[model samples]
Every structure is written in C-alpha cells, then in structure tokens.
Target: MFKYVYSLVFCIILGISPSFSQHTEEHAAATTAGHEEEKFDIGGMIMHHIADEHGWEFTHGVKLPLPIILYTADRGIEVFSSSRLDHGQVYNDYKNEHEHIVRVNADGTVNEAIHPMDFSITKNVATLMLGALLLILIFTSVSKGYVQNKGKAPKGIQSFLEPLIVYMRDEVVKPSIGKNYGKYFPYLLTLFFFIFINNLLGLLPGGANLTGNIAITLVLALITFLITNLSANKYYWKHILLPNTPKWMWVIMIPVEVVGVLMKPLSLMIRLFANITAGHIIMLSLFGLIFIFKSWAVAPAIGVFALFMSAIELLVAFLQAFIFTLLTSMYIGSAIEEHHAEEHH
Candidate 1:
C-alpha cells in the first residue's frame, strides 16, 4: 500500500512540472508580443502620448461620453455633459471646410475629427472652480489666523503661511514693484500660489496638464504684459522711446528695445508651457518603457528607471513654478524701476 501511494505522488509531480513550464513559456511570449505592439519610433510615440483626446473609445460600436465644462461670460455657465468618444473622428477637417459634419459609419468607424474644446461638462468646470475655491479657502483661513493672533506670535496655519506671505512681499513684490507694490501684491500673491498649486497638482498620476496648455499660459502671460505696461510710469516709456544712448545708436536701439518689451512676456509664456509639457512627455515616455519592453525581466528593470525619472520630475514641478514666479517678478521690476537711479550710477 505504501509503494502504491509513493508511485501516485511521483506521477502527479511529473505531470505538474510540464504544465508549469508550458505556462511560463506562454506568459513570456505574451509579454514579448505586448512589448512589440507598444514599441514605435520614439518621436511618433512622444507625439501620440502628448496628443489630447476628446474622449475614450472602446473596441465595440458603443461610444462613451466625455464631460467638458466651460465658463461663458454672457451665458453664465454652460455644460456639455455628454459627447460621444470616437477615437479617429476628425472633427476639424481642413479638407472638408465647407461643411460642419461628423461622419459616423455603421461599423463603428468615424471619419470626423473630434476637438477637445467641443466637449463640456459641469464636472470639469467644477474641478477648476474647486481649485479656485481651495485657494481662497486656504488663504482665507490663514488670514483669519493672522487676525486672531494679532500682535501675538503666529501659530498653526499662520506660522506656516506668514513666512511665505512675507517672503513674497519683501523678496518678490517690494524688490520688483517698489514702494507702490502694495496695489499689485494681492494679484501677485494670488498668481504665485495659484500657479504653484496647479503645477504640483499636475505632478499627481492622471492629473491634467493645466500649465502645459499654450493657450492657458499665453493668457496668463498676456495678463502680466498688460499689467506691466499699464502700470508703467512716464519714466518707463521715456527710456524706451528715447533711450540714454549715442544719437546714431538710438536709431537702431529704439526698435530693438520696443521689440524686447514684447519679447519678455512672450518668453514667459513659452518657458512655462514648454517646461510643463516637456516634463509630462518625459514621464509618459518612461512609463511607456514597460509597455514597449513586455518581458517580466525587462519590466522590473524599466520600472526602476521610470520610478527614478518620476522622482526627478517631482522636483522639476516645483522648480518650474519657482522659475516662472521669479521671472515674472523680474519683468515687473524692470517695467517699474526708476531710470533716474540708473542715471546716477
């Protein structure tokens, strides 16, 4: 009876070993195929990852809707809560400019292109509104703490916020905008904090790139440009129009100086947009490695490298915010600085 039991166990072990080996081989092949499918020319892969989509689509004919939110000046608030996601639909076909049509075939194919701006939802607008609300709530709470602790040492939230507030006032506003900087402090402080928070939020997994959008950054930079020029005193324009230079040099320098005025804010827009976009691209590329390499052996190695890049990106997110704020302050300072003081030197 003992011999019979031992023989049964031996047979079972032999059967299991072959089955396990086959399973392992199958898994490896699947991984390799997955990796191969994900691989593309690096440039094409980067472009694919960065491109925005109106919605996500499934393999079947059924379409999933994406939510979009918009704040209209005249309409108060508008939400397009549901819009079908057709993955290759060209909503803005330059080739067919005469018609505003989106073509959908019965076989789950769409010839019309979809635009990201066309989709809208209360949720997406709410996210932006919520972001604004959070900023207001945090600052308001901090302000209340300061009021309650008047003449006494700041504690709790005040302890944390007071230093940053003072730093912005002294280091950023005062040095940049001078004694009359009080008027601009509220806007500058709000802009700095708002940008910093948005940037940090974008670092989170699956977060949208608020700053990476050129349109958004351009609007912000344009505001700064408007504020700087509008705030510029007679002295600022006098220097630009009649720069303190040799007579012959003035002819060349005046046009160049005027161009520089426009170029400064343009640089601000491009810098923020490029940096934010580049960081996102790099992070996505690192993650793509796992999909592109497939094998478990390659996955572990690539994942470690991807993680290292993410960690570095975290620091970059903060640094980019700081750089944007610093440059903005500098531009404001240059616009409002005293020419008489420079002449004295």
Candidate 2:
C-alpha cells in the first residue's frame, strides 16, 4: 500500500515538474533583464493569474492554444486555432481581449456592432473537461473494485473513497432528506466529490479556476433549484404559496416566500463563486509579496505565509464542497418534507 501510494505521489510530481521548471525559468528571465529594476504590475499579474484565457499557459512563453469556435450571421461558423489571435492581436477579423473573444474592425479596433457568439473551448472549459474525466475514471475504478471483490475488504481507491461515500449517504443525505434520501444518494455523492476535486485542482499551480467560474456555479445552483422544486410535495407548495397564517398577512407573506424560493439558489451561486474567487485572489496576493518587496529577505517570510494559507485552503476546499452539498440536501429535504396531522381521541 505504501509503495502504491508513493508511486502515485511520484507520478503527480513528475507531471508537475515540467511546469514548475518552466515557471522558474520565466520568472528568472523576467527579473534579470539587463539589471534594470522591474516594476511589478501587481494588479495585472493577479488578474491574469485568476482570469480565464484562451490558452493554457505553463509559463511566460509556453502555452497550449485551444480551438476557437465562433458563429456570426456573416460567417455561419468559423473554426480556427486560438493562436491565430496571437494573444489578442487581430486575426481574421477576430481578437481576444480581457478573455472576451470579439470581432475587430479593419482598423484594429473592437467591432462591437458585429457580435459573434463564442463557443470556444478555453482554459477553464478544458479544466472542467479534465475534472469530469478524472471523476469518471475514479468512480469507474471504484465500481470495478466492488464487482471484482464482492464481499471482500475494500482496497486501493475503493478504500479511500468508500468511507466518504458512506458518510455522505448516512450523515448528509439521511439526516437532511430523511426516508427519501435514497433517491438522491447518487446526485449528492456526485456533487460532493465533483466540487471537492475541482476545489483541490484549483489549488495546483497553473490550474484552471473551474469552481471559481460564475457560469459553473450558476449551473450547479440552478440544478439544485430545479431538483428542489421538482421534488417538492404539495405540502411544501402550500407552505410557500399559501402559508398557514392570518388571511390578512397572506399578501405580504406570500411574496416573501416567493422571494425566498429565488434566494436559495442565488445564495448558493454567490457563496461558491465568492469563496473560490477569494481563495485564488488571496493566494495570488501572498505570492505577489515577493515581487512587491523586491528583496530576497522577504522570500522566506512570504513562502511561509503562502504555505500556511495553502494548507488552510486544502481544508477550505473540502469544507466548501460539504457546505454546498449539505445546503442542497437541506433544501431538497424541506421541499419533500411531509406534514403529519394530529389525531384527537
């Protein structure tokens, strides 16, 4: 078991070492340009690190350009490599600016009049795909283990994930959704692990901000909202639409309840987006300390601070995933909750 774990650790490092070396070289190059004092553009650096891009940048000069797909009335569908944009330089009347791929006029300016629907597979999109693939591979392996080792002790990845899965089912789903929890076990499990894995992935250097993306969080929250409403019993709707209150209070109370229906998902969306984005910003800012100081003496202090934060981030990643899943389960529970009537003797 130890050997297997060590091998896995080694493979992960082997995968990341190339990017680390590339980043180191690039940082060195940037700092040693003819002995001139380099002014660190702190805001630019932070935003660049956090923002989505058309390419996956390993370092200064090393990037994997993804495909750019656009649709405009003039052009039915234009498919091309992102490299043609040349990192925001106009290409074939299209350009990428501030992560927004837009059409450019002949005179090298944004052509706002000509809007094109961008359907490009960007860095964040690529990372999302990677996360999905990893999730599939992991669950598939675990399922195979269950089939092959029936009635035997769990081993390998099964051992690692089984407890967590069971906890999610027993503690989270059961407590929240009660008797009907079985129906939502799969979705709750998937949501917990998917968010947890993506959160961890965002911690990696050169990693994509998958969960930090608003679109991703919005979709996740939307799904929760839909499920909550769709699974809602008539009793739940009665409480929302026609609360057991004074008839005179119905006018105000009903609106409040209606607003709450919308607020639940909105809160979920903002919570995930804000937490993930803040984590990235805080980490980047800490790393930026060395650049701001322009001195090697602060490197040790900054490194220590950053290391501490990274450790906290690991905990936070699991925590955020748990909170989201727990709240979702609670919402579903509320929706499907059954009311019992009192019996008089």
Candidate 3:
C-alpha cells in the first residue's frame, strides 16, 4: 500500500513537469535564440480523467454531452445540454474552468458572489447508474436461472458467479457474522459485488472513477456504520457504555468507546479511497511517463510495467471489496452477538 502511495506521489510530481516545460518555453521564446515547441499538460490530463465532469469522455478529444441543470435565485432554473457550454465557451452566466463549471460575469471573469447550485448528471453519476443497471440485469437473470433450474446445476453467468458468492457467504459472512447471518447476507453480498464490479469497471480506459470518489466511499461506510449500531443489542452497548472496567475508569472508557464507533467508519472511508485512488494515480503516472520522456523507445518498457500494475490493481479490486464486506460482517457480529451469563458474571 505504501509503495502504491509512493508511486502516486511520484506520478503527481511528474505530472507537474509539463507546466515547468511550458514556463521554460516562454522564457526561451523571450530570449534571442528559440525553437518552436509543444508542451504536455500531464497534470491537467490526469485531473481531467479523475475528476467528475458534465460529459463522458469517449476518447482523447471526444466527449458525450450530458444535461446541465442549474438553479439560481436570479435565473430561477436553467436546463440545457452541457454542449451549450461548448466545453467552457459559453453558458447561462457560467464558464468551464478545468472541467468545473463556475458562474462568470459579463467580462468573462469568475463570479465568486453568485455560485449556482449545480445538479448536473455528471459522468460519475451516469456511470453509477450504468453499474447499478448492470447489477440488476445480472442478478435478475441469475435469479431466474435458479428458479427455473430448481435443484439442478447452475449455468451461464450463474455458473461463473456461484462459487464466488458461496465463498463469500460461507467463508466471509457466515463465519464473521455467526449463526442467523442470513438476514444480512443479501446486503453484504450486494455490497461486495457492487464495489468489486465498480472497481473493475474503473480500470477500463475512460471509465468513471466511481469507487475512488470520497463521497461514494463515505456513503458506503456510512451504511455499514448505521447497520452496525442500529442492529446492536443491549449486550453490545453495555460493553461500550458499561464495560467490565471499574467505576473510576468509566470516564475514560465511555468516551473512548464512543470515539471508536466513529473511527470505524472513518477508517473504512479512508482505506477504500486511498487504495483505489492510489492505484489509478499510479497507472496514469506510468502512461504519462512516455510523454515525459518524449521517446518511443521507452514505450514497450512503460507498457509492460503499467500492465503489471494493472494486474495487481485487478486483484486489489476484489481484495478490497472482500475485506470491506468481511470487516462489516465482523462489526455486525460484535453488535448482535449474544453474551452468555457466565461470561458477564
């Protein structure tokens, strides 16, 4: 994980070199001796791909426009295609800066005073919808196969996914969550497959960074946090609020336990975000190296390294989803666990 993070930082540094090269070009142009040159905007390129935008990038230069919905006190409500903005050219008192739509004044400067509420169907949101639809299609078909096949062997996608699902239920969920885990099995399984599928999709070129987005991870963790505490039995709260510790330690123990509740979700959020984002940044950085070196000779080497990293990321995708689901099961188990009278006594 640390190696992945280090690679990400190194890539960001490499990404900034384009701006440095541009500055050098400007300086050279001012001098007596100068030659024409092109500058690589590595930072911009990486950010453009990583950050959510109002349009889907289909290729290096092509983007499919999405609807732009904005609401302002003065304009009331404006609905139009994102293409109207023309990739930052013009829109209802707004302009695109670094793929971020910001309100602008008549003079074409940022209008800091009037920040319109943007409710655009961004690329990230669209990809989320797509992922959700795919999940529905897959599971729905698998369900029909189960009903129709009825006591027979699985087939088609069901055959492929059955072992993995069974492994998750038996190995990860049942053991960690204990008996009567059936109630939470569906939720855990859905969470695992949803995250795993999204992670894999993110690896595709021009795909949305759905799982890497902090907001998405935050929401996912929040669900686990709520489920853990909400399903907690009297025994669970008793351990935290009225632990086996002496009365004198209550002051420290209670607060510490309360903080621990919050920290679990926070850790979940950061772990998923950092791991997924670091993987992507590292991959992008490897691709950026070819432009940085300006040499075709190094292409094969970089491609091999990037390909190797991608394989690792593929494993990470499944690993992270499984870890997250397993931890969630453990938390749930701890909450709903029945404490024997002998143990408490």
- Candidate topping lDDT: 2
- Per-residue lDDT over 1-345 for candidate 3, one digit per residue giving the tens place of the 0 to 100 score: 110000011112222211111112221333247654456667766666677878887565567889888888988778888887874687767887766778988899899888888888998899899777777777887777778888999997667767777888789889988897988888888788778877877777667888999999999999999999999999999999998889999999999999998999899889998998888778777777777787778989987887778778877877888888898999999999999677746
Each model's C-alpha lDDT?
A: 0.57, 0.78, 0.77
- What's the C-alpha lDDT at position 114 in model 2? 91
What pairs collide in candidate 3?
none
Candidate with better TM-score, 1 vs 2? 2
On a 0 to 100 scale, what is the lDDT of residue 343 in model 1?
82
Instruction: Tally clashes: model 3.
Output: 0
Which 10 consecutive positions of candidate 3 have the poorest summed lDDT? 1-10
Off by over 4 Å in 1: 1-80, 86-127, 342-345
lDDT of 1 by residue, 1-345 (tens): 110000001112211110000111212323544632323344554543344333322212333455544343333434442352243443222111111223344554544444213334322233355457667666676767767888999887657666667877788678877777777777677667666666665555434466777876788899989988997877889788998888899989999989999998899899988987887777666545554565456767666776676666656665766676677777777778776755877
Q: Against the true structure, candidate 3 has what lDDT?
A: 0.77
Ranking by TM-score: 2, 3, 1
After superposing candidate 3, which stretches have Cα over 4 Å from the reference? 1-34
